[model samples]
Target: MTTDCSSVAYFSMEIALDPALPTYSGGLGVLAGDMLRAAADLGVSMVGIALVQRKGYFDQHLDDLGNQSESPTAWEPEKVVEPMLPVVTVRIEGRDVRVRAWRFLIKGLGGHVVPVYLLDTALPENSPWEQKLTDSLYGGDAHYRLCQEMVLGLGGVAILPELGHSLISSYHMNEGHSALLTLGLLEERLEGRALSSATEEDIHAIRAKCVFTTHTPVPAGQDQFPHDLVSRVLGEERTAALEVTGACPAGSLNMTYLALFGSRYINGVAMQHGEVSRGMFPNYPIRAITNGVHAVTWMSPAFGDLFDRHIPEWRHDNLYLRYAIGIGTSEIREAHVQAKRRMVAELKQRTGVQLDEKVLTIGFARRAATYKRADLIFRNLDRLRWIATHCGPIQIVFGGKAHPSDVGGKDLIRRIFESAAALKDVIKVVYIENYDWRVAPLLYAGADLWLNTPQRPQEASGTSGMKAALNGVPSFSVMDGWWVEGCLEGITGWAIGHGPESPDDEVFEIAALYDKLEMIILPMFYGRPTAYAEVMRSAIAINGSFFNTQRMLSQYLANAYFRPAVA
Candidate 1:
């Protein structure tokens, strides 16, 4: 299980390898951790790089009115990760700042391990201001974010050699956050050459050694720093050289643009996202590779045992999950029920909400962003109350956190609370506080249906629904993100509308959501138990088998990593 020195060096801003490690804010970091875990399982030669958030991503709390509050996450990284002896330095604002690293070994099912190196800027030798650079995840101003990215990109590249990974043939930028690594590569190429000038051949050579994955489709999601800031942070000479090579444009240093220019292979996380990205950056070539979840990590213990008994090969080869259809419907129902009971008990313990296990439980847990439409289900409260009274008894489990700065996201949470109170007599609703890695699995496995309603195309590649599928829970989502491909109407799960192309898309989608729940979903759950279980089995067999990191890593191996590096 030892990786080759010439393995792919995967760089991301954060890595959520474990619940105890709060280095991740949301899906992107979780996805990075899953990718590494799968890479280890399949023996894909790779090492991951990220920043060690000492203060960690903030702990989420909410008031009685659903007003969000933030608190520092207290955890000891030394307790979880092994510290490496070597220290590297990268210049920031004309001053040399020292960087250290810690390694967390992610052991896969096959006894293979992938080492994730977390770069840290907190040291006694470094200035007090520099020491606090690695203090928080997605905290601080734009300058602070730029510095953190530098520690991950420049410092990560520098320390790899010190950690005996000098021969890394390719660098994979998981997102634009780590695009500065390309600059480190460029500097290495320009060694013994003029710093003010860079040849096309040098740029081409660096591009050949790199790959980039863009997760966000919207313009605001892309990180863009002013050119003056880039010059101040990374030296004026280096900035001028980067401009010469077309990595940093004239006005601003667009991180996504830099990555696109420096990478030979660039991809979006989903098929629709790829098309959207091509429209955004028509000049560059971009391919689509739909994202996937790590099956073993996401599967509930109850379903895990079920899969172990039925689809034994699922651990090593997730494609074997397709055999889940062979498992009896009764067995699937029992497993799902057991998982639901467990989640109910946990939710009761945490939030004091004793949800009915027999009721049709709907789960909606993701980043509480405006476009995610957390309040979409409650748009027509009168219709919702009618459905609850006539169709069936239902309970909802809401779990997610809004960014401290996003007032709109926090307002959505407040709206949900208000709706929950308004419908308290008709249906039960519970909003779980501090939605993290620990809470995500419980909600995914416990709920009868996983709900996702994003404003089309905004959701790049959501994997929460995929996790629910592994646990025998069907999704009720919009035709966006990975759901665009994973959704198989009335089979695996239900779709809200076709796509976002319709002029009355929102009207159509909300109506469809109500109609499906009232007419189909609730009736099937309460009346036809065997039929409901069959759909659950199909979810595991079809969506769970295909939407997994095992398949995704293989695609990367053939299409990106294994491609010959340029000289």
Candidate 2:
């Protein structure tokens, strides 16, 4: 499929188009995939560029002691994608590194296709070390990561003309990983003119053609390379030019700073994230385009059937999800029960632990990062046992994988297993291993409630809860990320703390979590079936309708993508 140059060229280091692809690490890639799916559904002119991970992100394996280990996740690219001939090359460390591309077409509801071109460095023309650049997703040390970024940013832009996508109107840097694309654009501007003639007008001209989305609130999450390292990798002259233009500060080559300096439009993935980002970079103007999921992709089969019968237009327009409020209470309950039964069977099949279909099932899955506070619920084991044994029979399902280097994150997983052992007799706890896109939908659709407990302001935008909402699963989370916008006290779901400002104290939040579950959530769930179903209906209607990529992509088109091209 050929794309016109007027299409939006979305550049990211990873793209999680499908679970089997393993070209993604976590939320960022998943969000990108969802956006592309929505773009196809809406028929927006678009194309995606990302690195083709050969070995892919590592597969998660746990020892008997619950220590996390990783092995290469293997898959055949030919099974899902076709290779594009005529390799492109980018200068790296004063050497030419040849890059190739693979095409994966994502078909949408109306049969519209969005072509995603994944760039790969593994080729016969490249050296052994150069070939290894694209071997794994988010692998290697700082130097390796920087080179991967170069291939994705600089090389991605260089290949567009060769791939027949040279007429791109706007370049979107999904994150700082692909910020180097700006440098390539800058180089193009300085081609005929003398380097000394480069002015602020030239910088502004390039900035007008690009937009950026910053995903993390944490300081360390952004990439920053040392000056010497950057000088060595990217030639000293080019590095000096970047410094002269104020793209790279004196100390180091801060990727996020470079992206901010180069892009005309900048946005955060959530409302709170937008505010936090602005605070982090007080000098820059940052806007919010909250993250959303592809509704049809995440809706459970049972719910899909239900929606098809009751609200047939939901698949076409997500705003039709608002009609979920008209669905009968019994019908909603039955659909959820069907989804729960399927999940229970799958869980038993995988882990040999039979979960009770009637019991309150809670799901918590995402990257096993420490800021996510995956172990917050297990903070007070005695209180948790009390809630499980005395208040209600509840089961907690955990799914996630920590990065190979994140020891603290792995420790969080180990602690969850330890807590499971301690509370084995009281409540059933199972940590699902190797969580990926295939298993995510089951957990989201099957669970009685979706749980998220991130430290306040740390979460950029948690789309997992939004996916759960699409399946009529109400969230019980802290007042953070999109939850601040989605939560409706007792209507959609319950909040952990009193509100957004309800103190960042862990003990206080945990106590509030227990109090809400024991007092409001459990009573309504066990004693009042009608009330519970109402909450489920509201979750779909209120959260799912608004927190969807249909709206998000439209916002991007209006606010970012379709802005007039630079003169």
Query: If scored against the real structure, what TM-score would every candidate get?
Result: 0.97, 0.98
Tell me which residue pairs clash in candidate 1: none
What residue runs in model 1 are displaced by over 4 Å at the alpha carbon?
Answer: 1-6, 245-250, 500-504, 564-567
- lDDT per residue, candidate 2, 1-567, as tens digits? 344553799998888898678999888999999999999999887899998898999899987567999999877776779999868888999999999899998988898888899888888889999998988899999899999999999898888878888778899999999999998887777885654567889888888889999998988899988888898998877788768755566578889988988888899999989999999988788998999999989999999999999999999899999999999989999999999988998899878899999899999999999999999998899888888887788999999999999999999999999999998998999888898998889999999999999998898889999999998999999999999999998899989985665668888899999998888888888999799999999999999999999999999999898874232
Model 1, 383-487: lDDT tens per residue? 999999999999999989999999999999999999999999989999999999997898889899999999878999999999999988999999899998888
Which 10 successive residues of model 2 have the least lDDT summed?
1-10
Clashing pairs in 2: 5-167
Error of 2 at 284 (Å): 0.9
Every model: Cα RMSD to truth: 1.9, 1.7
